[model samples]
Target: MVMQERAVRTRAALIRAAAEEMDRWGYEGATLTRICATASVSMGALTFHFSTKDELAQAVQESGGAYMTDLVDGVAARGRPALRSVVDLTVGLARLLQDEVVVRSAARLTRERPDGHSWTLFWLPAVRDLLQKAADQGQLRRPGEPRAVAALAVYLMAGAEARCRAMIGAGGGGDRDVAEEMDLIWELTLEGVAAGSG
Candidate 1:
């Protein structure tokens, strides 16, 4: 039992180290040696857990996806208006990307991977579905254009993600800055989608 616990701890440490390294250097520049050094583990230990850097990257991506899924699920359960939920989810995700190195690195790795799927693939459908729901509930100003609104929401969230990633890479900014940006985004989005905003 002790051995298994230690192995799990060591693996988690390595994943975090790899994420930090990847966040700093991206996929091509992150090295196993640096990851091991950062994790304070030996190469043997790292190899035991992850046979290749690609595998490590995959792990990071999965971890990030899990985090995002949890956030999305939580928002979905809130029973809020679908438009509000979409805004909240996007801002929540941006905050996650801003604060979590693992998530940020996973996003970067996904971008760098040749076979990696787009992050939008994971979130866009949810956004579109929620937009459709909003329209069904008579929540949207343009009830006939849920697709257009979904596209706009996706573009805004994608932009926020990119901006947050860049800010994080450049050593981060105040949480207030992130909040303000999200507030502005929500304001604009609500103006476009609110029931009486026509």
Candidate 2:
């Protein structure tokens, strides 16, 4: 039990360190040696836990996805999430990326390198659920295909993420406005490019 506990602790430490290195220097540029150093774990320990740098990158992504998912879930668990929740999710994620070392690194790291197929598995089902609920509530137009609409919603959220990153990078003026614009964009990217003419 003690050994297992230590292993878990080691794994968490390594993931945290890898996230730091991955953010400052993308996956390729982040070396195992550097990660080990940041983690203060021996090279052998890193090798024991993660076979390769790619593996470490994958671990970081998994951690990031979990971290982000929990953040969204936490907010939603407080109430029935809204279109406002979607907006808050993206903006909150961007804020997390700007601040949280682990998640921030995970943000750019996943894009920097596509290691395993874990990302799709981790996110898809939740996205499908979100889409189905939005459609049922009439908060979203009935998409021709829920799966395709879910995918598009993910794409739109990515754009919102980029906007937040850009704004944060530029020193954070007008974040509320940018967030509002993102909310508008998400609303617009729905069933028909054209709205009802009535």
Candidate 3:
């Protein structure tokens, strides 16, 4: 039992370390030696837990997907208006992007490694469903355009992720600023796209 527990801890630590390296330098730039050093584990230990860099990156993405699942579940639990839920989910994702290194790394990896599981798959379907609900509820200006609105939400998320990455790179702004900016953008989006905006 103890051995299994230790093995689990080692794997978790390695995932976090690899995520940090992957988040900062990207997959190609992140070295196994550096990941081993960051995790404080030997190369043998790392290899035992993760046979290759791709496996480690996939693990990081899975971890990040778990986080996204939790966030989506939490937002769904609130039972808010569908449009409101979409806004909340996107904003929540933005906050996660700013705060979680694992999530940041997963986002980067989803783009860099197209063959890997995408973290977006966890939450984007929920966003699309919410947009469809909004259309059903007469909350959208062009009721037939739920997919288009979902695409816009995708763009918003991509922009938010980019902004968070920039902030991390330049040591710019606080968490509150990212959330606030997203909130303002959502407000404008709602005004323009919601049912009756003359």
Candidate 4:
């Protein structure tokens, strides 16, 4: 058990260090040597844990996806009210871009194409199901294509995060601004894209 615990600690330390370094220097600049040094682990240990830098990159991507999934699951269980939970889950990520860890990691992933969400097709259906249920329950308006709507929601969520990060260190965007953009999108969605609601 002690050995297992130590191994787990070492892996986590490596991920944490890699996340920090990736944020600081970006993917092209992120070096395995720096990660090993930051984690206080040897190259042999890193190699033992991960066969290659590619493997480490995959681990980080999976770790990030798992983190997002777990967060959605956790908030759903808390009974925080459904709509609030949706907003929080969607836009709350925008709020996370301010964090050194999340923002930098995202920057790194974008810099490295393999580390990005190029395979989100697997998760899109599940998201479609949830939104379809929401529309059925009257919490949201649904068009004939729930999958398209789900895709739009997901795109907007990620876009909001990127836009937020782009605006960071500028101190210009507030939650109110985000809320306003969301409100406009929702209005357009719920009321139809017809100009002036004509």
Candidate 5:
């Protein structure tokens, strides 16, 4: 039992170290030696957890996807109005990307893997579903245009993710205040979509 527990901890540490390394350097630039050194683990230990750099990268992406899935699920559970939920979800994801190295690395990895699943695959459908619900409930000013609203929401979130990546690369940290920027974008979007807001 103790051995298993130690292995679990070691694997988690390796994943985190790999995330940090991949976040700093793209997948092609990140190396197993550096990942092992960062994790303070031996090559054998890393090999035990992940047999190859590709496997490690896949693990990182899966971890990130799971985190994002939870975030979206939590927001959906709140039963907030659809527009509000969309805004909150986008902001929540931006915050996750900014604060979590694993998430940031996963985003980078997703971009690098042409065959990998897109992060939008997780949330875009939710966004579309919510917009449809909002339209059904008469929450939207232009009830006939849920598709357009959904596209807009996706574009905004994608843009925010890109900007966050740029900020990280520039070593600006979280100084950009992504949440506030998201709020402003939401406000502008709501003005166009909210019912009777003229």
Candidate 6:
């Protein structure tokens, strides 16, 4: 029993270390040796858990996807207004990007490895559904254009990811809060940015 538990812990540690390494470096740049060293486990242990780097990357992506699925499920359980839920969902995603290395690595991997399992797949459909609900309920400026709104939400998420990466690269000393910023951005988006004709 103890041996099985230890093995499980080792595998978890390996996934975390791999996430950190991949988050810092792209998949092609990350090395199994560095991942094993970071996990404080032998190469044999790593290989026993995962035979190749590709397998480890897939595991990391799956972990991230699970986290996103949980967040989406939690938001849906609350049953908030569709537009409000979209806002909260984006904020939740941004917070995850800021705080979760596994998510950051998985997002990077989705971009770096087009063929890999996409972590975004977990939440994007939820976003689209929420946006469609909002449109049906007359919450959108153009009720017929949920797709455009969904694209906008995606852009916001991408910007949040970039901002978080910048903050992390700068040693995390920045004062700006991503969630607050996203809320304000969403408000401005709904209100429109162009100056009104007098």
Steric collisions counted per model: 0, 0, 0, 0, 0, 0
lDDT of 3 by residue, 58-172 (tens): 9999998888999999999999999999999998999888888899899999888858656678898999999899999998889999999888888888899889888877876
Which residue ranges in model 5 land beyond 4 Å of their true spot? 192-197
lDDT of 5: 0.86
The C-alpha stretches of model 6 lying farther than 4 A from their native spots are none
Alpha-carbon RMSD, each predicted model = 2.5, 4.6, 2.3, 4.5, 2.4, 1.6
lDDT, residue 144, model 6 = 96
CA lDDT of each candidate?
0.84, 0.69, 0.90, 0.63, 0.86, 0.91
Clashing residue pairs, backbone N/CA/C < 3 A, model 3 = none
What digit string (tens of lDDT, one per residue) describes model 2 on residues 139-190? 7545445667666657765675576567656776763655466556666563
lDDT of 6: 0.91
Off by over 4 Å in 3: 172-176, 193-197
The candidate that wins on lDDT is 6
When summed lDDT is taken over every stretch of 10 residues in candidate 2, the lowest stretch is: 115-124
Q: Using lDDT as the measure, what is the rank order of every candidate, best first?
A: 6, 3, 5, 1, 2, 4
Q: lDDT by residue for model 5 over 145-171, one digit each (tens)?
A: 999988887788778778887886687
Which of candidates 2 and 3 reaches a greater lDDT? 3
Q: For candidate 3, what's the RMSD? A: 2.3
- Model 2 C-alpha lDDT versus the unseen true structure: 0.69
TM-scores, all models, native as reference: 0.91, 0.65, 0.92, 0.67, 0.92, 0.95
lDDT of 2 at 110: 58
Native-referenced Cα lDDT, model 1: 0.84
Q: Which candidate number has the best TM-score?
A: 6
